[model samples]
Target chain A: MITIKDLRKTYDGFEALKGVSFSIREGEFYGLLGPNGAGKTTTISIMSSILKPDSGEVLLNGKNIYTHSDESKRIMGVVPQEIALYNELTAYENLTFWGGLYAVTPSELKARIDEVLKLFGLYERRNDKVTAYSGGMKRRINIAAALLHRPRILFMDEPTVGIDPQSRNLIFEVIEKLHNEGMTIVYTTHYMEEAERFCDRIGIIDNGQIIAEGTLDELKKNSHARETVVVNFNNLNDALLQKIHSFGSDFKQVDNMIYYYTNNLQTELSKIISQCNDAGGEIHNIEIRKVNLETVFLDLTGKQLRD
Target chain B: MIKLALKDLRLFVKDKRSMLITFAIPIALITLFALAFGGAGNSGKDAKISLQLSDLDHTEASASAIQIFDSLKNVNVLKVTLEQAQEKIKNGDEACVLIIQKGFSDSLTAGKELPLELQYDEAQEMQVGLLQQSLIPTVAMLPFNIGNAKAVMRNRFDNMVKGSDDSVHTQIHKESDGLFDALAMGVMQGSGTADIGAGFFGGDIKMTKLVAAKKDNTLGLVQAVAGTAVMMLLFSVVGIGVGLLDEKQEGTLKRLLYTPMNPINILLGKMLSANVISIFQLIIMFLFAAIAFGLDIYSHLTGLIITILATAYACSAFGVVLASFAKSRQQVQGLSTLIILVMSAIGGSMMPIFFMPSFMQKMAVLSVNYWSIQGFYDVFWRNLPATGGTFLSRIFVLILIGTLLNSLAVMMFKKNILKLS
Candidate 1:
């Protein structure tokens, strides 16, 4: 288990992490969800022993990460957002080099390399230079390198940001398999659905602070954000838009569609239907969404999860 | 299209290291080499070839022969005893020794030549070869001693005619005496008039030029030092190119810190590799120098090793400092090329420091190339003993440079990499 207490970091007088605190269980999947510059990376950097916080204590297992940095880093793996790899080297060579840094025995390293390459489906391209690999393949190899040491806890920062759907799905499968095999993973991503799908518990970070943390259901119970009632009108003319606006300022109109958020969607839906009917526009379709992570993020920060 | 070409040209020029290497280094090298060698090519006018003369023949003819040599532009005739001449050649003080045998003049006049010995240290191959070539034309001038012989013959014929009675032989001898006088006067007076037989009359004089073993010689040491020092700079640059710049740009350098290894160890490991490679470079250069230039590097083995290690340390330190300042491999290449070229030019590696301007010579101390070259020069060129204070001073300065610059580079890297982050 890894624990972070009152993590604070200031960079050039700008606070990147402000008194942020969190913990990861031994075999849990924790997702940190935030937009850009929301301290997700800063928090992960500190947690993975890559960067130090100004005033914080990060304990890996039972040892403080800073005081026992080498021991802490030994059991932790970090897959950076960027592909930190030697392009001139083959995939096997890259894995061997990183493994050597971890002081893996030669025989064990060879076997582990073969195992990891097969796992990542890059065994066939083991002899090819990393520069020859595709973007997703390169990312897979990058993750494979971090796992060479078989770290107890893996810190993956936006591992699937910009890749094809096929590659992304492969990565998701690998993460799920690793989590299933009891590898404690601290996954950071701004993609709402990935967090909702993968994370056993989620932390919503914004403006260098974690504003809320819980499971999907628990967060929904705590958030004041209502279910969204999206209405598709046959005619979303100015008359229908103005009549819908009269219900509340929370209702938004987009071509032939109107969206309204309310604590009670049933009551608000009736009022919206009456207003649209009065404006001479018939409602074609409607969607009532309960409070999701994105809704909670919007409700707390008045911004999109990816904003 | 022309505007696009102009934009590309601007971008190329904006890469300051590349621009400096392309335009500045070559131009500076050319200018400096021209300045250094231009005067060296005309060195014949400034310094004469030193030849020690041991004239065992005490005759007037031998003195005249010596005088003839003194008048020549190529040879500086130093009159020493045979023992002194041998010592001078052994010590490499003189290029060669010329020993005129006891009957050198008599044998020349009698047309029975004796051996004229030319002694030289064989290790001074280039200098000895040049001096031997000059000796041919100078020695060929010996047949002109016939002028002195003719004067002696003419005097004898005059005395014979004065003492004899008026016999048939006396009358014939008297008649021939006028012809003899005319011929004798012609050989003596016209000898100075026509310069046709000027340089090559000493061929009939049998001479043996022997290679003498040198007792304490440091010939070709300067060339060895100069060549080895320049090669060390190249190795340092290559080391930096492959090690620091490549790893940093590849992100492997930063990633190495993620391991259990300390950052200082990583820096030291890179430095150690560079230093070792540079030492090997110096060794290879010196080995070739010893083979080709006939340099006796092994004569002062301890000094050579110390100098090599010191030079490698200093050059490798310079490489580390240069790499620390650069942001990318391209920058390292361009900047190192420019700096190395400039250092080699101002230092004694590209040319002898003496040949450079006084200001450049003074500024040469700022370059590590100068220190290394000067260290080698001190031990080899100046023939200072390897164990002396001067030799120790050179090594000390190099060590100081290595220590200071390496520390500064490490400090700067730490500040920029960790503190800035």
Candidate 2:
């Protein structure tokens, strides 16, 4: 479990983290979702004791990480956005080095290295230098290195960024397995789908603030934006669009497509299709979906997730 | 910390380019300097001074003088005509020329003054001095021969008149004949050339004696090896520093800080690796020199080991400080290259410090290489016994300065690198 209280960090004349705060329960996979320069890495850095925040306290099980750095950090592992591995060293060697720094015993260290190398499917190339590995393989080894210490909590910052889909799936599966095994994980990424699929709770951060934080359904329920229903027509006219707009104020029509945002998609679908038929337009298809994190983020921050 | 250092060392060892830069290049340079500066195996031969001789006198006395020059172990006499001798001296082919006058033997036998001509080029002052000193005793012995011949003849005539016996008269006359040949031989050979005429020409003709120093050539060999080795050690340390910068850029340094290890421990680990590698580099170089060239590095065992430790630590600390100040790997490389090369050149790595101008030699004291090379020289070349005075001063200064620099580097790393990032 981790608690970040009133974290504020400044660089030069700019404020990177403006009094952001959050917490993660044990055995929960929490994802900090944000775009580039949204200060997710900064928050992770401060919480992991890699960087000291200007005015904040990161408590690991009720111990301030900065004040009790070693004791607090002993139970944590961090996988940075970058590879953060020695290209000249083999995967096995890199694991051994990281494990050794955690003060793992020789026997335990060897066992852990073997386990992680096997887990990451890098056992076949364990002896090869990291420089000779593929990007996906390197990312796998990077995660494996963080796992060598068997920490209670793992902080992975954009672990699957720029990696192949296969590697990304492999990483997702690993994180799923770890979460199922009751491991506390704090995953950060800008990929809304990944956060939706993998994270138990998602925190949407923007401009150094946690703008939204909740489960997928909770976020959707909490956001004021309604579910969108998109109806495509073979032929659409302005009169029919106005009639559809009369059903709800939150409506827009573009080309042969009409969008309707309502609290109830099922109740609004039939009336919208009947109105389109009355206008002599044949309905092509209808799509009904709840608002996702991207919409929640956009509605809350007035910016796209990728922005 | 030890684990971190070992990991860094393993990484460096695994990288072929790093190994080449740290070890292979330095070894090649050591071998080159050894070969160029006479650091190969001892051949058990003292350096010889060459002399050009023109025997225009052609008499038995002059012939005997030429034979004396030929028989001397430290002098190599080359036979040349007067014109050839003059040409050789003008062209710097010969250090000096010795020409025997036409009436030299006649003048000597008549007990009259005779001066043989010695010609040399003024530009070759050192060679000219050595040749002049070598010839002094040979020239002074000429005047002593007349008095010795007169004494021997007087002894023979007194023995015949006193009626000592027919055998006594014969013995005295034979002894006088032997004395004349002995005197002729002495007059041709220089002092210290024949122990038979020891002190015979003392204080005569302001005769100069050559004092051979047993340490000069060996000192030169050690300086060449030590200077180059220290210079290359700096470059390798800079390489390690650049490696630190790379790790920092890649986020490994920050990741390490996230562990239970202290920031000081992280830097100390890197410093330890650099120091260990540098020390090993020096050991390999010294061992190669000793095995291949018979350099007596182990003669002062304590001094050599201590010098290696102090110098390695100091250079490694310097590298860490440089890395701490740099923001990128390329910046570290460019900055360290210029600084290390300048320090090495000024500190006597590319050439002997003594050969530099006096001000440059004084400035050399500021460089780590200067202190390291001087310490090695004290141990290997001067054979200063490894006592406290000779090398310990250098060791003390190195350790003190290294500690200060390393502390600064650690502080800078914690402030500028970790906290700022």
Candidate 3:
């Protein structure tokens, strides 16, 4: 188990983290979800042992990490947002070098590299320079480089940002595999669906504090059981959108589709239908589904997941 | 530690800029210098004299004087009837004019001495007094040698020219090495070589053929080239440091910091790779210099290697220091330009240190260039034993400084990384 007690981080008199505390248990896929500048990066950085906390005790298995940093750092693998592989080197070469830094012998590095490359489907492109790789390819290499030493704990920050759907799926698949294989992962991102689907427990942080932290099902059950409905309407312009918005405050139109969130789904549906009929708009198929993690997040934070 | 160092080496090789600066630039500069300056062959150096011979006495005695002047190497013997010589003397072209004033062979046989005038262009002549003093013995020793050789004539030629202490009337033909020969002699002998005919222009003394050049010219040539290499090689350190700055800007350095590796080890790996790159650059330069300039770098290679190693360490340390100080690649580029330009200029990279001002020399001592250049001079010009040792010690001191600077840089870098995170 990893525990952070009263963690504080400041930069030149501006508080980034103000006495926040959290703990991640063993064999748990924990998500640290926050917007930009919410101290997500700082929190993770401190946890990864790259940056020291101002006033905190990071205890790993009852041992204070600050007092025994060398041992603590050795157990964690960090997959940074930025692709950190050396561009001038081949992916395999970068892996070889990073592994060596971790005290892995050449023969060991070679064998492990082969395994990881095959796992990521990067074995065919192993000899290509990182600079010559696609954005997705580089991202895979970055994650693979981190996994070379097989750390007991894995920390990934925005690991799937800006990649294609195929790449995104591949990354999520790998994360799933790692979690099932008993690697305790501390993942941070702004993506709610990814957190909803993947994280065993979620920590929704805002303004340097974790406002909500629990399993997805538990958080949803604890909150009002509301279903977010997708009404994909057609050609409903601005004047019509304003008239329709009067039906519910939690409603936004994107292209032809209107997404609305409400706890009183039966009443909210009647209001939407009446507004559509009065506006002389044809109502499309109303797909009814259970409230997802995004709706749960919207109810809690009052913001969209994509935003 | 060794494994980590090797890992750093792998990372270093992954960087193209590091390889380019340390290997490419030094060898290029060395080759450029070898071509621009003397490689193995000094270009067409021979005897040259600026003289004005005015024959006032056009009789047999003066004619013989003119004949000796004509026989000298590259000597422009002007046969002006004493009138034209006067105009040239004021023009500052001629250093000295040999004047045969109304002297005949009859006066020498009758034992009556006549004055021989040597008019000099005082403005053009830097060492007129020395030249005048030298002319005395040369003019008198001429006919004495002829007289001594003709023993059948049974004449004592002991009393050659009778004149005052400062001024002597000529009684013999002359022999003298002009200014170019003197300068060449100064340069050659000043370098401390054991050779005879290097300055010999026969009067009565024969050319001493006993001495031979001990230090091979090829090895000396290579040593000179090494000086140029040392000057340009310092810039390579800037390249390595800049690589660090680039990593920082790109956020890779921050990522690396997240690794379990020691921050100290990280700095160490970089510095070690930088040193290796510098050494490799110098080696390539020497190898090419040997092939192109016929410079025998193989002879004093151990000495050269030490100097190279020391220089590399200094540069690596300097680069790390620069990287820590720099916040961006732009900052690194701007700062590297300032550092490399200043060091190269003060350290005598563009020219020889001897040509640099004494104050500049004082400043240069603070640079790796000064020690490197001095070591090169010892190897190339003097070819003296322990020149390499002297260079090696200075280089070791530089390496020590480099190590200290690198440590400081690592500390600074750690702080910077934390801030960035």
lDDT of each: 0.74, 0.75, 0.68
TM-score of each: 0.67, 0.67, 0.67
Q: For residues B265-298, could you state the per-residue lDDT of candidate 1 as single tens digits?
A: 7778778888888888888877877787677778
Residue A62 error, candidate 3, Å = 1.4
Clash list (residue pairs), candidate 2: none
- Candidate number that wins on lDDT, 1 or 3: 1
- Lowest lDDT 10-mer window, candidate 1 chain A? A246-255
lDDT per residue for candidate 3 within A107-189, as digits (tens), equals 88899999999988899999999999989888888899889988999999889888888888888899999999999999987
TM-score of chain B of each: 0.56, 0.52, 0.51
Order of models, best lDDT first: 2, 1, 3
- B1-421 per-residue lDDT for model 3 (tens digits): 9999999999879866566556655665565345334462233231234456777666776577667656654454667755666554432223457776664344444433434666654322333444444444454433432222122111222243333332331222211223334534654666422122122212221111111124454333533575568756767777887787777767777877877676666667777788888889878887878798876667767666666677677777787788887777766766576556667666766664433333444577777666666555444434435443544566566777777887788888777766666
lDDT for predicted candidate 3 compared with the true structure: 0.68
> If both were scored by DockQ, which would come out higher, candidate 1 or candidate 2?
2
Give the TM-score of chain A in candidate 2. 0.84
Q: Whose DockQ is greatest here?
A: 2
